[model samples]
Target chain A: MSPESEEMMWCHSCREEYDALDAGTCKECYEEASETEEELKREIEDLKSKVHFLRLSSPIESDLSPSDVSLHASSDRKGVYPPVPAHKIVLMSRSPVFRAMLGGEMEESRSGVIKIEDVSYNVLCSFVQYMYTADTLLNEQLACELLILAEKYQVKHLKFFCERFMTSRISNDNAVTNFAFAHRYNSKNLLESSLALILDNISTLTQREDYKDLVEKDPRLVVEIYEAYLSRQVNTAASVKELQNV
Target chain B: MSPESEEMMWCHSCREEYDALDAGTCKECYEEASETEEELKREIEDLKSKVHFLRLSSPIESDLSPSDVSLHASSDRKGVYPPVPAHKIVLMSRSPVFRAMLGGEMEESRSGVIKIEDVSYNVLCSFVQYMYTADTLLNEQLACELLILAEKYQVKHLKFFCERFMTSRISNDNAVTNFAFAHRYNSKNLLESSLALILDNISTLTQREDYKDLVEKDPRLVVEIYEAYLSRQVNTAASVKELQNV
Candidate 1:
């Protein structure tokens, strides 16, 4: 094709001249795609607003009067944190564990007070906040802490949220630790990502302090990791052999 | 280009040979567009799941015990409908009107029982359900009912939801009526859509029974519609003049 003819061609998106190989979509398809993109974006905006609308104002934030239930975060020390006010309906709806505790003929239900032991005030507050809003600002430390709380409470949504955050942050340094945490919590998504990271760095796995700790604390978990690594290797080899035959 | 050369030209999307005039995007741009589409879809899925997680189960369905407040629908009849149970926190969070009634030392707040007058049991139930779930099935009638209830309670989200439904269902048949409803409710979105529909069929508008009623009931609204029509006409005339000069 001549340069003059090439210059005649235009992109519908950026509206610049392009070679046939540089073309994206035809005019009709581009218009259709633009409409679809707009529609998808509008849907995202609508869903976001819905999420905002559904998010309950946190009891702590609202300073709501006459909250039905109060949760106390009891540390190992004698000093107990101030009570975290919440409702039984919200607590039960968010977690089956909370439901079992608050819905049944339990002392917690009767007294309208539940003691959450071994958790700091911050984690307990964040956990309750997440139940109301389905959101929280998370760091690695917060994610790990919240993941434990989420798992214990059986709040699958928050567990998944924290697990996803932790999984994305997984690296060679924390792979073994994350793998162990995932295994303990039964977070399948986190477990897979962490185990894959561990498998990728198998040569340097034992040198990590967490690896030694895992081995001491749970030998079976270490053995299972090795088994997964071996299975992946065998699968890779089989795929390569099949490709060679083809 | 010869017929044989034309055979080489193809669209990546529809997989069809096309002339230069029919050319869409190039292969590289097509691939990039595909990636963008996939990312948008993934985002949509994530948002959808977040919405699902955030949606609180309606109290009616859950049969949750220990509900803190009760809503009674009082019709002028001798028999009052059964009270709809709900949490005060949900009510306050969802509606500013409910918040004021419940949050302050109002009669409802003191008694823990709110008598919602003029709404039937079904509409009141659906209203409560929407407050919890952010969802309710809607037909034209239902949407109208819900929109009224939503506006009365200052539930902006639900009011918007119903307005959108009403707007989508607008036609020449109902445009004038919906326009009046929108004006009454101060629903700006619905008002715009309904007014546009009315303007589009302005030739036959005044002949409509609702238009006559609106003229008799509110001459000011009718005059405003005419003013809007005149402004649009003036704008169109100026645009035409500019095009002719060019």
Candidate 2:
């Protein structure tokens, strides 16, 4: 086709539409643009996917979940959303006793304090790493705030460093007990995912020596876990195949 | 064998040991106890298997993940998990923004200042459901606390209830970010397990439209996610295999 008679195409990268005359350079550019656009779309999707996985992977992934309808009901009746600056939110998180309980897996019961930095693998390391180099040590909330900031800015390395560090110590009891609350808060999905990951550990514990002790200590739970396990689960084809192998 | 010297088998339900213990009601409590104890071992194994399943299923089912290091470094600081909390993590997740984002299937941009929840679907949900239905709510953290209390008190229902609630929402991002800190603070295995799960998600995004976008947005990330995917991923086998037309 003659250049004069050929159609034009738009070049997003160049920000100017050009002629597609004979599959015009414009078309070439648009295809290139499409490749670019397609690439951007893919990146956003990928980042989202990563976030999803990270949320599930966190030890206390159930942070976003809420309290029960009745407990919140009286409060909800007064207002739909809780007040901002979330006084109770922060205060509730600050309980040293709760923290002790939370860290009970490693720490002895409510007899001690559990620093936020101490819990996360990365943040603890970061705090320790930066303690010498940096002037100030980050407090628990500050650490969480920093993590939120890192996430917002797409500071991936920071997120990993922080998240992996913190989630490193999420407990099965923690994952299980907090399940509802995690879903209630702003971070339900991540919490759930993490719990799922931990379930295997808990499941294995059902038969392990440590868990055997746990069962001997709390046979009732072992029984309940068994009932619940039998209720909702369907055998995986892989598992069924494994069964056949056995 | 003669009836006078038959082997005694224990009965599970009645706690009686019978001779070659065929299934039967035993008036002898000691015999029944012996029978029940023997069967308990097998039941414990079954419970362990269930718990194991509970753990693995979430990370596998969640739709999110983390990003690569080098490529994501530019837009990010080479270390940050994504910022936007998974809608599922938010409080009253039935809120408008979530409805819109999830309904629209727009994973890129989150709208409004969404509220966070404190719920979960991990192993604890089932048990927690039975306990504390009114006035008192088991927030995610509280739920975790409750699970611990349950564990301490031998309240198996509460523990598993929390776990199930937690595992259900593992796909959303917000929970992961928030809880990682809590988890890491309390446990180590939970952190590593979470890291592995997030890593798996990162791998899944590659070679798809989302990963392609990462490449376009930041060419450097291309190398990262790709590398991560290649390292951990074996194959993406479909759960249901298609039959070929002959």
Candidate 3:
């Protein structure tokens, strides 16, 4: 409309006029970036199709394949649950624990029935389904339970999946509990994030019941938290001192 | 640097100074594009891990799983090649043809051996390997052979893979042959690309030996090519007349 407005450059992306101060990349860079984005999107589509093609129909969802092995989740209060049918090849392929257990001359391999301790029937079903599809719907509780099972059976991908889910769901409310769980399962990512969250809210740490319970159950873990907090405090103080010196 | 040079804007990406005419995007659009690129990259990484998790070791490559089925590729010159061992569930999952044959009371299902006629041993092995892993290395000749097997078995993913490979290798020399092969296999992508290449070099079409052979073997295919070329010519002439009127 105006001479000044006409002189303002328009963004090729958003098509909005902006001053030189608000400039981003040049035309060549912009074209290169756009091409890179398109190439990345194409790669994503190709990989997604490959995942779809490789994914097998879960045996629990279908009875097409005669399952050679069945998993029983042993429950103390409710008695034995119904067996979760799975293929030995699938289980072995997914987990080295299962591979060793099923591939060797073990009694469970001979019987073709595996008795898993301390996991619920629902959790076991989801676990087996993940082995087939590399996918699962996860709430916080399921994430925690599956992480434990994943850690025990050495399913690194599932363990990483659960850890990422748990990390996303981390809050001040469950920071202490998640910290303990992460430590137990050797989830480095979860441990770092949960510890960071706990230290960020260190003043209210002792007031929480879970924090107090963790203090009583595992005083060493509580001490580790304090050590991290103290180390952070020292680093901040030293940085401030250096700033004043400069 | 001169005062005028100092007044020039620098790209955030390449850090090169550019004038108003060379401007790309505003700061907001640039930041958003960067974030989108990062998200796409993260998604690609996630899908790649999922693919790795979902990929099963080919039974032909491993002795871990006791395969319940074997495939014999019947060759006229070499006689019957060694049976390619594969899991029934894998075959059934990958191909509907295999599913129908294995799931029902077919002779192959009853006997646990499938006879694949008119395919070489190497091609059959690669086909079975692809069923397990959703991957195979392909040359032009192998891609053509595998496309035929993939078509017969109705393994759409493998067929698509081979078609994509063949399409990439399409040249003026092979366009006629590939066009016919694509038509026979109902490979729309390969057919379109090969036909485009053929039309681009239509002057030399009848001069090639393959073109002469195609005319003798399938005259209807040659007619279809001429039909496409004539349609394109008509569309061009109409556009030229419209431009002259304008």
Candidate 4:
């Protein structure tokens, strides 16, 4: 309850939400989450060490080409490949205690020669880094970059951050609306957070000039919010009428 | 490219499609875009000054009850009126940006008072602001909120943001895969952008984990991207296999 207390914590596995409570993993999925964390951490650390060693190797062999490492060709050697991305960054970043056990600096272990020209590769690296660490102060610019990276690699953790980072910045109305679009397909937990914001501010949100633009893109949000307040079964015709007034 | 170059503007309105150049609102829509921007700016500014002059006295005067404002009579005034949330910081901080454009704070506005808690009010206010302004940031958040809010109020922008922002984030492989979905759903420009991303980065993105996610979300993206590359030839099955191999 202190002002200096940490903000934002929760286990996606259990969907039990909390902000800054530190018992470490949620009680329900603690072992499963912990086991997964350890395995992935080991893998990430191993990967990072390889990458760092690769980078530290003098003359940084810039020779590896995308054309050379053809995934279609069975014989395309995997030794000097591009960077990797994963879905468990935010999940991994959840427990500082867990991360410390894994041996830090995950990006330091990667063992490939992924080109920066390949945006996907860079995104993967970023996700790996994000896995080991994340903080409020990380650059918004980097956050934006990592989001694109997350989406590119299909890294759910990075993608989650894309959503979470954006959510944390919801100090203004514009951000709320924009995020609504960005994380549209985000599964249940994220959807609920967004709903809380919109449902609670109906009158104010409804009256804005560009509100029509929002409506045009998605009339469903209006319908849903209307549904929230309607404790009684809403006749479709009357529902539409009430919505018109609301 | 020079970092000082102002010419390299990343116009969201224009560069809609991944490979396709920026072109969301057409050149013709420029007049409207400019007009809307100016009008919104002026309106918001005017409103802020008005609220400042009006100064509705109490930070927490008699709570504005949503039920009292409604035409329908209610016995349970408290049931109709939800207690305000503690984080309701909107009117208090008095964001100059909000004060200027929103005409009046939520309670002070024409709809009379609907007692939403502060954080919710701020969130809703942002959504409304986003709808009118087409502010990218707000829209993004609103898109996420729409799923929740849309289920309640029949608000369109929230849903619009949720869907459109996701579509708008399209670029490279993500766009390529997404456009394939967009094309399936009849999202024209979105399809265009997705195709562009795929077309441009098919070599790599086709091999991304999202490629698999896209396929899972809709096999159409896989087929359509194929069709896009090999238009109308109907050799999509072979191309799909090739992509699978990639």
> TM-score winner among the candidates?
3
All candidates: interface RMSD: 2.3, 33.2, 1.4, 32.6
Q: Name the top lDDT candidate.
A: 3
lDDT of each: 0.85, 0.36, 0.90, 0.42
TM-score of chain A of 2: 0.26
**DockQ metric, candidate 1:** 0.59
Best by DockQ: 3
Model 2 bad stretches (over 4 Å): A1-125, A128-205, A216-224, A234-246, B1-246
The residue-by-residue lDDT of candidate 1 on A1-246, one tens digit each, is 864574356666666667654555667787788788899889989999999999987887876646788888887355555789988888888888888998889999899998987788888889989988888899999999999988888888898899889888888988998888888888999999988888898989888788999999999999999999899999999999999999
Instruction: Evaluate candidate 4 and give its CAPRI docking class based on DockQ.
Output: incorrect
Kindly report the fnat of each predicted structure, to 2 decimals.
Answer: 0.57, 0.01, 0.74, 0.00
Query: Over the stretch A92-170, how does candidate 2's per-residue lDDT look in tens digits?
Result: 2223333234334544223223233213333433322221112124543544544553443343333333454345545
Question: DockQ: which is higher, 1 or 3?
Answer: 3
lDDT of model 4 at position A56: 12
Per-prediction TM-score of chain B?
0.92, 0.24, 0.95, 0.36
TM-score of each: 0.94, 0.18, 0.96, 0.24
Cα error, residue A12 of model 3, in Å, equals 0.3
Tens digits of lDDT, candidate 3, B17-55: 898778899888989999999999999999999999999
lDDT of 4 by residue, A98-177 (tens): 23322244442132112233344333344444432321234565666666555544545445646666666653365345
